[model samples]
Target: MDVMEWTGQVYADTPIVSAETYVEAPPARVWELVSDIHLMPELSSELREVAWLDGLTSPGTGHRFAGRSAHDALGSWETISTIVDCEAPRRFTWAVGDPGHPSSVWSFLLQAQGEGTVLEQWAQMGPGPSGLSLAIEAMPDKEQKIVFVRLREFETGMKANLAAIKGLAERRA
Candidate 1:
């Protein structure tokens, strides 16, 4: 995993982090893993649970879902996310909070690589209010540090997610 350069970004900067891995399985198999919202808690350290909303059973553009997440310092919270992009066997993206001004955005991108697939997990922090924003408000002096640390945590989690997906896809292939 390549370290993301987010040294001094503030919350308004909307810092982004991403990690990628090559999976021995094809894009279709990788898509099955990435598109399954319920499987995320199994792979992510922060996410505790997820459920599709409004009777939806699968992912699609404009679909919504609720996710519960927990962090040691931040405790736990729930966010309703909207699917902003959905391209089967290619990409899946969702925005946490309001889609027009999301607190965060996350994505999984798949590209065919030889006989396998290259999968990348990407995330961008707030342009909207979030738990981190509350922390920043409490200690304005540490805004940069807070953002940097959170981005680091996102990077670490994204790497783990990609690794887990790779393992699962290969084993099932």
Candidate 2:
């Protein structure tokens, strides 16, 4: 895996990190995995749990979910996320902590590639407050380093997520 480049960005920069893998399965099969919010914790390290909110059972634009995440340095926290975009078998996206001004935005994109699929996981950080913002508040001078480290963590986590999804999708295929 190539390391994602970071240029010491701060919160306002809204930096993005993405990782992708080729899955030996069709987009439909891969979509079943990515669109299921309940399955995410199984593929993620920092995300501990997720559940659909307001009696919702599936993803759709305007639907909401709660996600609990834990990081060693950042501790544990829960955030309500709203689905900003959902296109079956192609894309699924959500905004954490308010759709209007989210702390972060996350997405999964899938494209058919020959007999298989190319799946990408993407994330963008900060136009709002988050655990990272708290850390930055404590040490303003370390904002750039904090953002860089967090972006690296996001990149690593996305790569791992793609790997796990690839394994599962291929096995099912």
Candidate 3:
């Protein structure tokens, strides 16, 4: 949203939302923000709360977590997520719902650039069961519209998250 153009990808009918910004902090500084599962609710509006499961103290592949979210239109719900990828100081990714066939895939990619980290937040909705899938099924004729609205919501939220992380990382740095 800052200087990056609007970007998205599609995978088998699922819409992907991705946005990146330059954070005035080193990769390690930025990674501390991105890798902390418990910090999300503090930085997000829709994400009301989160917690790690299985007594995990840090993120790695196969770690599980739960998140609770709310929206004026969507109301409130809780989700189960699994860490699908974790590459320190560079990339982190996770899957919502069933890990084997996730309802959504979300990721953060960090690249060191000119003393700072270019942090990107990404999300892809549904190749399996999801609230979006349920909504689409309920209104098959409005699939495109549904996807558009949902992706827009994600885009806006991700941008806000990036901005907050940038501020925090820069302040701490």
Quick one: how many clashes does candidate 1 have? Answer: 0
lDDT of 1 by residue, 1-173 (tens): 77877579899989888889999999999999999999999998999999999999999999999999999999999999999999999999999999999999999999999999989999999899999999999999999999999999999999989989999999999
**Which residue pairs collide, candidate 1?**
none
Provide the overall lDDT of each model, using Cα atoms, as 2-decimal numbers: 0.94, 0.93, 0.86
Number of clashes in every candidate structure? 0, 0, 0
TM-score versus the correct structure, for each prediction: 0.97, 0.97, 0.91
Predicted candidate 2 versus true structure: per-residue lDDT over 2-94, tens digit per residue? 897769888999999888999999999999999998889988888999999999998899999999999899999999999999999999999
Instruction: Order candidates by lDDT, high to low.
Output: 1, 2, 3
Which runs of model 2 end up more than 4 angstroms from their true locations?
none
Which 10 consecutive positions of candidate 2 have the poorest summed lDDT? 1-10
> Which window of 10 residues has the lowest lDDT sum in candidate 3?
2-11
lDDT of 3 at 65: 94
